[model samples]
Target: MDEIKILFLSHTVDYSKAPYDTGNQFIQALRNNNAAYLSYVQLYNKYGHYGAHHYLKKYVRDNGINCLIYGSSPSEFYFDINYLEKLRKEVFLVMMTGDTEYYYEIRDQYYAQAMDLVTVNDFISTFKLRQIGINSIPYYAYYDSTKYSKNGNLAKDIDVSFIGTLHGGAGRWHNIMHLSANGINIETFGSDSPNGRITFEKKIEIINRSKINLDFSGVSGKTRLTRKHQIYKRMKQIKGKVFEYTMCGSFALCEYAPGLEYFFEVGKEIDIFHDKEELLEKIKYYLAHEEEREKIAQKGYERALKDYAVERAVPKLISIIDGLRKTKTYKPSEIYLDEEFIRNYTTYRTLLIIRFITQLKFKFAFEELKIILKYRKLDLYQIVIFFKEEILDMFPRIKSVLKSIFRRQ
Candidate 1:
């Protein structure tokens, strides 16, 4: 039998000083399994949206890639459905997402319908997608055990620590502040924290050193206007950090999210809190009871190592992928991409282009422009319509006046 040639497309660069992030670890897992001839292409930041899709299709055809795994995100919007439909015939295409809670309705579901299989990070999302007739499976986030493991020598001085960005109005700041106000000596280390962003090694070190590493399942604050309904909603999901914290042999006090119990036994392997009061109570109990804390952490670490380590998880994923390839059928859905949806999508893409240009990212802006021109075919009428909406969006007064005028008409 010929070796299954797989092309993994994702953004691999660690924007921070971290040597390697999750994407790199995932690729390493595939290689370690020796399941297929894996080839990687750094998408998004490297090639923009349209460029990434164009390059991906060409790469797959040229390199005989029978399996294509896309680390899908909402950052890039230029994935032409027609293009995906054609490519699905050639390769067993799969889409993986960790933030399905936020993007599922706005972006992911449309793309997922075109995929041969969809792997989600949370069980609830898996169930939701499957209910809707999509071939979805629970693929929990795995960690590099080499980097994230128990360091017995490191002293657990920090009582509690949260190591992630605090931008999302998803109540992370509120939670941290609430804990601190109630006399919990909490330390935060992320983009908006006092410590700012730290290296990947530093993150792992902190996790190992902290008595209780905090994990918030809330989505990031990077949602679009169309997705405003999700803003500050604090809809929790099974985050990757849940595994990352436990894998370091550290006690993880996570915000309770539905379907988290499927991954770890709450209060046995790990612990969770639903509200601020519960979280505060748990922290106090855990802090005083050092032996109990350590026991839970140890059990969590053992579970993570045995089940969620990249080495163990990847092989299972490959087996599932193989089985899926043999049995799954391609059924593309086009109902979601109506004329109104296209206009909204194009407007969002235009916003991204404007943002890129303002940030002096000319290459990305140019790439977006090229794709918009080619696919959208924006003529005088469409351009006029876009700018009018853009103008109305920018000025509330203008929108009111326009509405009043239309109403008078």
Candidate 2:
């Protein structure tokens, strides 16, 4: 069969790493799938996407783009509707990221209006979208472990080393406390996860050198303590880290969650933890049982090569999209909504507005009021992601305030 010409639109070209990113996954997948001309579309240099949404028309029209796979971002929602109408048969689908409410503004309005189906990277999130009356397909970004297989060798230099982020949240603190208290001599080999604090090569080095490489998925805050929806993606979404760890022949110690079984036969390929007591106990037992650990790692390595290749998975992704296009024609529903509600009330923007108004009204109590109000209703992870992106800008300004900011990036 002739390869499909598909243009993928993403907010990012890459997430800068193997475990949590889609870029490496897609590039390798296309190669494995023998996908002809699997071009990825990103809008960093070609002007802001809102503007490119207009210009992309000319580009899409000129190029024989058989199918359009749109990715997430508030600005990258709209396509060249005018040109798409002209080549009405060409643009096949729109894949929107529905993980956060950042896209929710135009989700029901413009996004669902532009494409055939919704694609959620998280299976649990996809089910949530379906539960809330929106139809979506669950798509997981996979890995081509050929590279890892080539470099998979355990040289006993480090006993236990972690290459993920080690700052933020109670879990992060817990990790720090445990590592410190245990005196396991475990090096915080990589920077931090939240801040994306490690290099890809460094990751391989850490896994290769360390006998016991940690794979804690972190806690997905529950409904009583936190909203289930937000926690679901954090814990349930099978990260490439899980597979990457397995592929590198590192003995993984992970938390039990959805989609894990898809990769490994828990306790065989990877060891899982249920609680702190179980985790510490398992780590001790596995460290002692060198032969058993090696056997499990070898098993995981075989399984990763056999089951979790880019070629095997990418076709599955395309097939899901193809199936969606087949079952339901890509007729986007035109929607109308109040512009006021969709207003971009960014965290910085809101603070700026508040600061300007407060300075004019009162100066003495404004600082106190601002401090009290800022913590009242902001999603913590949003703050973290935002800080990670704009840390340089915010660093200088808030250096005095965030004295103990433990950023690993």
Candidate 3:
């Protein structure tokens, strides 16, 4: 077979600029295997949607770009479905769902028809998409082994550390505060934390320096504190930090999430906790037993290097992509076009608009409105729901009564 040329498209220039490093690791892994002539474009940053569409079409034509991997959601770029469909004929289009829990219904499913394959970050999401007849696969987030290897030279000064955001409704702040109250000194570093966010270099250093690295696998819903948001905050999924912690040779005590055991042997390779009490108890035990903690950390590091490295996973991804090209059996689902489905999805979208407006993100709310109008005309029911939510914000007691009435039905 001929070499597969790839074009990696993302919203940011590179990994350093990106909020997450998953895309960069994938790009690096492709290069490591000498797969093909790979080119990268930060479409949104370089050009606006219209300009990006024009440039992308011309660039793909001028250059022999056979595969295009989009790292961001279709909604963020706002690419026309027709434009994507036309491009699909020429290239193997793959879309990556970074936050599948929230955006899969609102954003991803709408574009799955245009994609040759959709790569979900978690296992449950992959299964969900396949059930709906979309060609999907679990592309577990991997770490750059070259950059995140075990560093024995660093001193383990910190007791426990968490290197992610604590904002939104994930309940991370509550957990951290609980641990602190119980005398577990956690050096927190992320948005909304006392220390604030750290640099990429600092993150690696902190992970290695900390005796026990902490991970919260739960998903954060909308910033607004709603019943739905509260439910979402309790939902768990495999986190990218799981690989990062192990790759850095740090003993991780991650929050228990389903499907985590498939990747690592719990209690042997890495540890997990179900609640704040367990997390606190485990932290104390591990801190006291140095040798046991070191053994688990070493095992996790070996496992991560062998199985979860980006270099190791990219070949499998390439094979899957190649096989997909040969078979071409994937059929787009018409479920997104169903009237009842559209109505439900629109209701979800309106709730998101309310979320944005309440959070003072007027621009995002306006963009969501545009997306809503593009597909289906706004109806009286949607308008009523929007106002009802707004009024509910004013009268909490009345809102609670209505919430219970709806739940019982």
Candidate 4:
């Protein structure tokens, strides 16, 4: 059999600032298992759409790559839809998103229409994409057990722990803060945490040592929208941390969500809580009963090893790409040049143009403000305060401006 040539593309967003990441791991998994020949591409931070297209086309031709895979991205500030449409006839395109709830403001709608196969973690996002005629699969988060495994030497001494941004959880952070205030000791780490940005290996150690690992999937404070700020709506699926905690042989108490039941045996394999009271109660109970916690942790580890490990999940991804290739054959350039494609492509391009203009508007506005501040002879402290308020006030206006423009069109 001829080797399958796959091109893996990902934006730079690493939890661990390692040279290799999940995209590389996926490629490694395929090659390690004698499944495919892969080329990895990390989109350059400074490259524009034209540069990206130029490099991508050259690489694909040079390597004879037949499939393209896009991994998790921190932001979707740039994309080339026309280039993707042109390449669609020659290669199968797959997009994967590990994030579903928080940082959702960064997702691009154009991605749903461009890729041949889309794999998202949550059912809600999958449903939303499928409604737009996209082929979306609910591929839950997976872990490489080799990177995250139980260390016997690490003592399980911590009572409860959470590892993530504290500012983004909306109502959930308030509950955690309340716990901290009430004298219930909880270890934490992340950007918002006092200790600040622990290493991925240290994170695994913390998880293994803690009795219960708290995981939350809630709205971020990025937008000024009141609903995202005030509401405590539960996300429909489990977060990536759930898989990591479970894979590392740690007991997790995640925020209750609908689709988690499909992955785990719930109370048997993993624990979940709906509200602050339940979460606190579970943490207290589990801390006292080390034997029970260990039993649940072992079960979670078994489940993760059997089904959610990268070694197992990568093969399934390969099979899905195979089926996609078989089912979706395309004509040479004609499909992209057709009326439907033209209409869709026009709208997609228009959206990109509008986004570019809005970004430019924000840039010019900030520059003008800086000039005015310089001329006005404003002090540094005054300028800083004014600039902060301007940023906070300008973003919502920028969003509204874009919404109105799109609505008018």
User: Which structure among the candidates has the greatest TM-score?
Assistant: 1
> How far in Å is the alpha carbon of 50 misplaced in model 1?
8.4
Candidate 2 runs further than 4 Å off: 1-3, 11-25, 28-51, 73-90, 96-115, 132-137, 142-146, 150-153, 179-185, 192-199, 219-238, 331-341, 345-409
TM-score of each: 0.78, 0.65, 0.73, 0.70
**What lDDT does candidate 2 reach at residue 111?**
45
Which window of 10 residues has the lowest lDDT sum in candidate 4?
A: 333-342
Q: What does candidate 4's lDDT look like per residue over 110-166, in tens digits?
A: 555667888877766677777767778888644677987877788888888899888
Q: Alpha-carbon error at 14 in model 3, in Å?
A: 6.6
Residue 121 error for model 2, in Å? 3.5
C-alpha-based local distance difference test score of model 3: 0.74
lDDT of 3 by residue, 144-197 (tens): 787777788999999999888875436688888998888887899987688998
Candidates 1 and 4 compared by TM-score, better number: 1
On TM-score, the stronger of 2 and 3 is 3
Give one clash count per candidate, in the order shown. Answer: 0, 3, 0, 0
Better of 2 and 4 by lDDT: 4
- Spell out the clash pairs found in candidate 3: none
Q: Provide the overall lDDT of each model, using Cα atoms, as 2-decimal numbers.
A: 0.75, 0.54, 0.74, 0.66
lDDT, candidate 3, residue 6? 73
The model with the greatest lDDT is 1
Can you write out model 2's per-residue Cα lDDT over 303-368, one digit (the tens) per residue?
776666665667777776666555555443444434332232223333333333444534423432
| Position 60, candidate 2: lDDT | 60
